[model samples]
Target: MRAQIGDRLVLEGTHLGDARRVGIVIAVAHDDGSPPYEVRWLDTGRATLIFPGPEARIESQPPVADVSGPA
Candidate 1:
């Protein structure tokens, strides 16, 4: 999987009743947007480098709408 900074990393639970973990990609290790991202978890507010497993997926940031009036 590939990701950019500000993208969210979602790790789905592997077993029943397991909680999902979500984090923001604070840093990318590779220029091509590969794994080994530095993530700051939303739940615990802790940062760590992680090589995401199969259960992990990247959630790209939505495009920001233009609040300014149309030209």
Candidate 2:
């Protein structure tokens, strides 16, 4: 699967447990938006990241980032 930044990777009621987190795509993997993405999520005020495999289906896709905001 391919997804831009700000995509929410929810494991849902799958085997990964009922873990729910929302993180921004701080960084991309390759030139193309594929798997193994480094997602910086907010967990209890901590930013967690992981290189999830592309095989994992995305539950939802968030809107692309807006540079209009303060950088």
Candidate 3:
């Protein structure tokens, strides 16, 4: 999955259930955009940072400063 910055990532609720979290992609690393992402997410308030896999489904827009581009 070619997840670009500014995209959103929903912590697969179908799998994680209540524990599921969701947030938007803030920053990318390696300048190559590889697995083990370094995302700045907002789990419904509390700002959280994680390094999920590339296969992690992206939302492209959740709730945060869109890192995609443009205003």
Candidate 4:
């Protein structure tokens, strides 16, 4: 899957009772946004380079809403 920096990498648990893992894409290895991303895991607060498997999916950053009043 493709991802950009700041996107979240969610690795779904393969077995029952296993917790899913989530991480942020701190770096992208390819210009086209392909995998082999450097992720900073939320739970462990550690970074690692990963060639994500089938269980992995990318969660893009949500759009930022304008907080300021309309001008």
Candidate 5:
């Protein structure tokens, strides 16, 4: 798995009826965009280093630009 800063990590529940967890990639630990990313959980706003498992998936967002002014 690979990710960049600002990518969203979705962690599916292990068992039935478990609550899903969502986090954002705050920092990438490796140069190759590998695992062990520093993520901040949306639920609690807490940050931690995580090695994602099979239940985890990443949602990469496109770069944002200033669209307020005329093109």
Candidate 6:
């Protein structure tokens, strides 16, 4: 899957009773928006680079203050 910076990543738990992890994509390593994203987790407020697994889902949002658009 492809994602941009500011996108939310939700990683599903592998087994029952496991809690899902949620993080926001802070940096996109590739220009094509591939894996190996830098994410700041919601729980710990720490950042890490991650290659998403099969259970990962991307939640995209609009860019804050589109600079080129009319005010």
Task: Identify the candidate with maximal TM-score.
Answer: 5
Residue by residue across 4-65, what tens digits does model 6's lDDT show? Answer: 99999999999999899999999998999999999999999999999999999999987688
Give the 10-residue window scoring lowest on summed lDDT in candidate 5: 62-71
**Predictions in order: lDDT:** 0.97, 0.59, 0.61, 0.96, 0.96, 0.95
- lDDT tens digits, residue span 1-71, model 4: 89999999999999999999999999999999997999999999999999999999999998778999899
lDDT of 6: 0.95
| Tens digits of per-residue lDDT for model 3, 7-71 | 76766544534566667666665466654455665745544556665435776555567788986
TM-score on alpha carbons, each prediction: 0.86, 0.51, 0.51, 0.85, 0.90, 0.86
Every candidate's CA RMSD: 2.1, 5.1, 6.3, 2.3, 1.9, 2.5
Identify the runs in model 2 with alpha carbons over 4 angstroms from their true place: 13-17, 45-49, 53-71
- Backbone clash pairs in model 2 (N, Cα, C under 3 Å; residues 3+ apart or in different chains), count: 0
State the lDDT at 38 in candidate 2.
Answer: 69
> Which candidate leads in lDDT?
1
Residues 1-71 of candidate 1 have per-residue lDDT tens digits of 99999999999999999999999999999999998999999999999999999999999998778999889
CA-RMSD of model 3: 6.3
Error of 6 at 3 (Å): 0.8
Query: Cα deviation of 17 in candidate 1 (Å)?
Result: 1.5
Clashing pairs in 3: 8-59, 8-60
- Candidate 5: C-alpha RMSD to true structure equals 1.9
lDDT agreement of model 3 with the native: 0.61
The positional error of residue 63 in candidate 3, measured at the CA in angstroms, is: 16
For residue 4, model 1's alpha carbon misses the true position, in angstroms, by: 0.2
